[model samples]
Every structure is written in structure tokens, then in C-alpha cells.
Target: SAVISQKPSRDICQRGTSLTIQCQVDSQVTMMFWYRQQPGQSLTLIATANQGSEATYESGFVIDKFPISRPNLTFSTLTVSNMSPEDSSIYLCSVTGTGEWEQYFGPGTRLTVT
Candidate 1:
């Protein structure tokens, strides 16, 4: 089993700015994912952070916008660049297959871009 730790549980940023959230795991994990939860909406997969390699982003998300880095087994970071009002949402980091089909998620970094 692994535990997820996210920093700056919540924050409010200005438009045209950026915020980088960090994720730390208690144990070494192979699968680490970044997701976004829009206001009053479901979660959207952003990317898969590969250790020692660039993150693989999903459709509609690009590297320049959402840059991710997984330096080692138990650490990763995601940066949301050029923020906008529409970008106000909850950014979450999670690890899958911890138990059965269950995924362990961090408390999430709630970003409110003004």
C-alpha cells in the first residue's frame, strides 16, 4: 500500500499565472496519474507521469501547459501554467491498483484562478 501527499491543499491564483503542485508517495509506485476536476464536473485524466521520462498527456492537454515530472519512484510534480478563470479546478494526484480496483488519491490541490 502507498500513501499520497499533496501540498498547498488549496490556493487561489491570478489569471495568467501558474501553480505547481507536488506529490509524494510513501512507497515506490509504477503508475502515477494527474487529473483535473472542473467545478461541478467529473474528474478528467491529465497525464501519466513516467519516471525519468516526460509525462504522457491526454487529449486536449499539452506539455507546455501541463508539465509533469516523475524523478523517482515515490515523487512527482505537476505544473499548471498560464492559468485562467476556466482553469479553476481541483488538481488531483493518484495511484492505481493499490488494492483491487481501488485508487488512492491525494486530498487534491484546489486551485481558484481569478
Candidate 2:
């Protein structure tokens, strides 16, 4: 089992600005991913941050818009670029530990784009 932590628990950003959210795991993990949750909505996968490789983004999401990086087994980051009102949501990160079937998620970075 592992614990997850995210930086800047919440923030308010202006349109056209960008925010980089950091995610860290207590133990090494093989799968790390980024997700977005709009108000009153369920989580939507943004990308899978593969270590030593480029992230695989989900449909409706572009690499240029939501860049992600997994530097190692326990650290990853997601950057929301050129923010807009529609981008206002809670960004969360999750990780699957070795031999684990369940994934644990971070507290989430609540972003409000104005």
C-alpha cells in the first residue's frame, strides 16, 4: 500500500494562465495517472504518466494542453496550460503500487479558473 500527496491543495487562476500540480507517492508505484473532476462530476482520466516514456493522454485531452511527466516511481506532475473557465476542476493523481490491483489517489488540487 502507498500514500499519495499533492501540492497546492487548491488554487484560483486567471484565464490564459497555467498551473502545475505535483503528486508524490510514499512507496514506489508502477502506474501513475492524472485525472480531472469537474464540479459534481466523476473523475475523468487525463493521462497516464509512464516512467521513462511520454504520457498517454485520454480522448478529448491533448498532450500540448495537459503535459505530464513521471520522473521516477514516486513522483509525477501535471501542468494545465492556457487555462480557461471550462478548465476549472479538481485535478487528482492516482497510483497503483506494485502487485496492487487498487489505485490510491491524492487529495487533489482544486483549481478555479476565472
State every prediction's TM-score relative to the real structure. Answer: 0.94, 0.95
**What is the per-residue lDDT of model 1 for residues 9-42, given as tens digits with 9 covering 90 to 100?**
9999999998999999998888899999999999
Ten contiguous residues minimizing lDDT sum, candidate 1:
95-104
After TM-score superposition, the amount by which residue 110's alpha carbon in candidate 1 deviates from its true location, in angstroms, is: 0.3
Tens digits of per-residue lDDT, candidate 2, 5-106, equal 999999999999999999999987778989999999999999988789989989999989998989998999999999999999999999885656777889
Q: Model 1 clash pairs?
A: none
Over 4 Å off, model 2 = none
Each model's lDDT: 0.90, 0.92
Tell me how many clashing residue pairs each candidate has.
0, 0
